[model samples]
Target: MDHLYAMSLDLNALLRDWPFEPGMLKVRKVTGVDGREKLQMRIDLGVLQMELTGRPDGMRPHGCESLLSYHQNRAALAKAAGNEYELSAEECSELQQEGIQYYHRYVSLFQLNDYAGVIRDTQRNLDLFSFVDEHSQREEFVWNFQQFRPYVLMMNTRAKASLLLNDGKFAEAMREIESGRDAIVEFFQKSNFPELVSKSSEIAFLDEWLEEVSEKRPRSKLEIMQREMESAIAKELYERAAELRDAIKMLKASK
Candidate 1:
């Protein structure tokens, strides 16, 4: 009789090598046995392996790339037939679950400093939220998913601004942050949750980050003179203000 051996499914060696940290997102990219790149996140329990593209788990639902894509095609077909299509509560729940998979992938991508991937996934979730909000049969299902809009918006904004920062465009990054802040505020107001704006941690974080970026941004000579002129005028120093104003005019003319 031939001796038989079994392949072990245990992750003991893998988890032992990469111990989980308490407050850090530990992620890595590796080539799979099939020679395809994959993302692996280290968690407290063990490890999570994800596809670098497409669905995180690399599963296709309804023969479509994603649940969102599948539903979008269905909606398009219904529209062409002059029929209205709305997502049922169960379908909405399914979408919510699918969104979670994308969320995990984006968060892991962010940790890997892949800002573009982060933006792509966040934007996808935002589109998913809009679709469900527009077509969900129940308001409660819409609310459940839409409630996370602010957080996703913040992540998207952060990624855009980070890309600008990477290119050493501090002023542009600041503007991007401002735009993101406005978007969050608008979302709250439109959702009839204006009261939450003041208490929004996302908005507060962006505001603080914007201030820091502004303080560090390099200023042109003309901009500096303009700021000085404004300060002098506010302090009732007409002579200083007039001098700065004339200097600023000369600088602008030279430019």
Candidate 2:
């Protein structure tokens, strides 16, 4: 906890000042397996520009960091309460000092056989951290976040389409969906967790629920309508999943 207060006070100052280029630019790089060329990107941020002129590979621990960073203030809390390691019933106050606080707190929790406490602490900071902390939350977020760190990378046009659909920009969204199939699929394959190719239960329960969408749908027209809805949702999913497949191909080819 030494200089804990000073650490927060100097985060920005500690953050090295890096330069950026106009418009969307790239500033992250990775060397080829043979070590000849490097992979890169070009994108705009909320407020910042970057160019990957000649970058070096730095180990990015996005897998572990995202979860830890989300509940980081917890570490600061334990610190402020004084280094009390006695494992009686007590709530750790989340204070803020360094990002490392999150790392230490969880590390200790794991060592101290605090399974329930670990899950509780993680759930408590679910939304605040990033993912919802549900099943596969770590797998889902780790892969997603790792795919686009240092440079906030985006490898597929379907990602663009997802944004468009989200923003009510149907035309653009559909456009990418239609044309970017290969790119999307390729992106998925390159991802750390490729099985996300089939996204898990978000709103897909209709397929399962409909096996018996209530015994009430015994009528002719109701059954037909339910069947059609199932077909349409499935079609939409097929198209989306196909895009990821192509993205995977492209990524592997690039490698």
The candidate maximizing TM-score is 1
Q: Write the per-residue lDDT of candidate 1 for residues 169-205, one digit (tens) a residue.
A: 9989999999999999999998867999999999999
Backbone clashes in each candidate structure, one number apiece? Answer: 0, 21
Candidate 2, poorest ten consecutive residues by summed lDDT? 87-96
Model 1 misplaced regions, further than 4 Å: 1-7, 225-246
TM-score of each: 0.89, 0.18
lDDT of 2 by residue, 83-147 (tens): 53221111111211122233233323433443333333333333332321221234544433333
**Measured by C-alpha RMSD in angstroms, how accurate is candidate 2?**
20.5
> What local lDDT does model 1 show for residue 73?
95
- Give me the runs in candidate 2 sitting further than 4 Å from their true place: 1-20, 32-255
Task: Score residue 144 of candidate 1 by CA lDDT.
Answer: 94
